[model samples]
Target: MNVQRGSTTFLKVIIFLIGFAVLAVCIVLLPEAARRDAIERPGDYSLYPLLVCAYGICITFSVALYRVFKLLTYIEKKNAFSELSLQSLEVIKKCTFTVIFFIFLAIVYLRVHAQYTGDDAAGPISLGLMGILATSIIAAIVDVLQKPIKNVLNS
Candidate 1:
């Protein structure tokens, strides 16, 4: 039990750091990216809205991470099979889908912009594709976990 507790604590700390890192990146890098894009391609404000969307998605990601941390805390307290844990998982899965939706929007925006400007958008488009793939997987895993959690609750 002690070892399990320690591991969960470690995982919680890591999740906290990840949330922090996401905030830090949005704070420090996103504005710079927006500015750089504006300067490099004058009159092209398309990327600005995409950056905003990315920040919104980051907010969803943070919420999901917070839910994961809360779930971990419940697990540490041996309440993993409780209704609260199931709720957290449900929220996390919703957040994942939200992020995936935003990524899809970003991809569509980038594709249209690239077609208009005749620029190479493959790199950013590929990144968005990867995000969609990853979040879809996360959602699937969360759904799978939910089934077992439901069984546990019923038992």
Candidate 2:
């Protein structure tokens, strides 16, 4: 279902867009500090690809989150689990898994960056990554626990 119509959804889309912009700036600007002969540095912008992957995962999760909010509204209106709502929930579960998996991968990428550059930047990166991991875990648990309850409610 389309999420661009409602005012609340518009706010969510704006938030997502701002997040993407910040990520884009980081991916573009951070690696320029590396000198060509810097042995500790990768000397290449390999981190950009990983950042792109993380951004993609984040966008997917953001979209899923938006859809969930929309589904909450739909559920309030219908007071029952329509097929579309269940499908949306299932999709959200999958998105949660995807987000978690990508966050793990991004952690690995960040580790590589830390090792290659000796930049000691991993602390903040790890914290942000952990936040993403926590978000994914919460989403997964909520989805799993709510699915059957929603089904029973519909029945």
Candidate 3:
């Protein structure tokens, strides 16, 4: 039990740091990059839609991260097998699904833009595809984890 608690504490700290880092990247790095680009080209805002999509993904990602952290807290509190943990897993799965939806929307938008602009949108499109794939996997894993919890709750 002591070892398990130690591991949970370590995971909690890592999760906290990951959340902080993502928040910093969204707030500081992304805006600074946009500012730099604006300085270079004052009126070109083609990337703004992608930035909005990124923000959408970030919001969902933050929610999923919080849910994971909450699950870890439940584990530490000796409530890992409770309904709250199951709910956390369900929320995490939904968050991943939301992220996949946003990525798919971005990919569709990129394809449409590329049709007219003749620009090389393959890079971002591929990234969006990868993002969708990753999120789908996360959702699937959450679903797998949910089965036993549902069984436990039912029986």
Candidate 4:
């Protein structure tokens, strides 16, 4: 029990750090990058809308992270197969899907904008594609885990 408690605490700390790092990037790095892009390419207001969408995705991701933290708490309490844990996994899966959808939109926007401006869209598009892939995998894993958890809860 002590070992499980320690491991859960460690996992919780890791998740907290991840959340902090993501928040820092969204708060500090993204705006700076957007400002630089705006200055470098004057009169191109496309980035602002992209930034807004990205921020919205980040907010959803933050909520998902909070749900994950709650799920961890449940696990620490030896309630990993509880309905609340299942719910948290469901919410996390949905959030990952949302993130994936937003990344797809970002990819489309980047492709269109690149065609119009002749800018190299490869970097951003690749990044968005990777995000989609990663989130999709996360969602799939959560879904797979959910079934087993549901079964356990029922039994």
Best candidate according to lDDT: 1
| Candidate 4 clashes between residue pairs 3 or more apart in a chain or in different chains | none
Residue lDDT tens for model 3, 1-155:
59999999899899899999889989998898889889998998866887888889888899999999999999889887789999999999989988998899889889988998898889989988888888888899999999998998899
For model 1, residues 58-130, the per-residue Cα lDDT tens digits are 9999999999999999998889999999999999999998999899989888899989989999999999999
Tens digit of per-residue lDDT, candidate 2, span 19-98: 66656655664444333324455556665656566566757766776666666666556543576677677777777777
Per-model TM against the reference? 0.93, 0.60, 0.93, 0.92
Off by over 4 Å in 1: none
Give each model's whole-structure lDDT: 0.92, 0.66, 0.89, 0.90
Clash totals for all candidate models: 0, 0, 0, 0
lDDT (10s digit) by residue, model 4, range 40-92: 99997889768876887988899998999999899988799889999999999
- Measured on C-alpha atoms, candidate 2 has an lDDT of 0.66
Q: How far in Å is the alpha carbon of 4 misplaced in model 4? A: 0.9
Off by over 4 Å in 2: 1-43, 153-155
lDDT for position 8 in model 2:
50
- Candidate 4 minimal-lDDT segment of 10 residues: 44-53
* Steric clash count of candidate 2: 0
The alpha-carbon lDDT assigned to residue 30 of candidate 4 equals 94
Residue pairs with clashing backbones, model 3: none
